[model samples]
Target: MKTIGQPPFYSSFFLATVIIALFLGISSFVTYQQTPWKAPASADAKKNPLASDAATIAAGKEVYVKECQSCHGKKGKGDGPSAATLDIPAGNFSTAATQGQSDGALFWKIEEGRKPMPSFKKKLTENQAWQTVVFIRTLK
Candidate 1:
């Protein structure tokens, strides 16, 4: 038995555990605060998204085939091989709700590129990006 002046072995162990728990809790809170959470693209998206004309869609397809296919897939399904190694998974482009997102939103995403996705603003002209938006409208 240890005197009150000196902590017992179990007291030291308990103190150490409490210190570790405190450190981990603080670290977790810091990490959570540092991570940015992006809100969904549309707060109130249209019930029926705009449908681009065939001519525009065709122009957009050309741009997509040239610029986006390698990562987004030939069919815009986000299953391209390059997508596998990407930090952020490529978006699936076939669903109506997804493809239905506004042209402005799509253009911004293409221009800005999310995290692991590199921005194409410097690589492709804005017109090309808008055309890609048009092509996206045609996907199922």
Candidate 2:
């Protein structure tokens, strides 16, 4: 049934739903385009002072479990319990995109985090940060 001057209620609802879906799709694409989590050239040039020895990896594992596991997952897969709520996704250490990054770049990202990730510069020491990087390398 249709009124002369009014569109059907379902048509209006459908149109609104379509608009919302389009808006959300566009916004997600825009966000992805803007979030280029790349470390600077200088950061890439920096080095990891700690070796990936057993002791260092052990220490890194401890820190990661305490600080990063909530968002990065126990296995560094970026599918932690809280990952679903984030505006930007966490880095998945198992991926080649992550494994290919230099140690310094990973260190920089951990030290100076992006919007959803907090900076660890003050929370963790340089040694600990490097140790975490070592642990990350083992994720692959």
Give per-model TM-scores: 0.62, 0.77
lDDT of 2 by residue, 1-140 (tens): 55798887899999999999999999989977665678888888897888888999999999999999999999999999999998777978999999999998999999998878999999999988998999999999
**lDDT by residue for model 1 over 4-121, one digit each (tens)?**
8886789899999999999999997875454442335662242223357777678788888877887889888887778887755576788765666666777777887766667899
Note each model's CA RMSD in angstroms.
Answer: 5.7, 4.6
- Predicted structure 1, TM vs. truth: 0.62
- Model 2 segments beyond 4 Å from truth? 1-29
Give all candidates' CA lDDT scores. 0.73, 0.91
In angstroms, the error of model 2 at 2 is 30
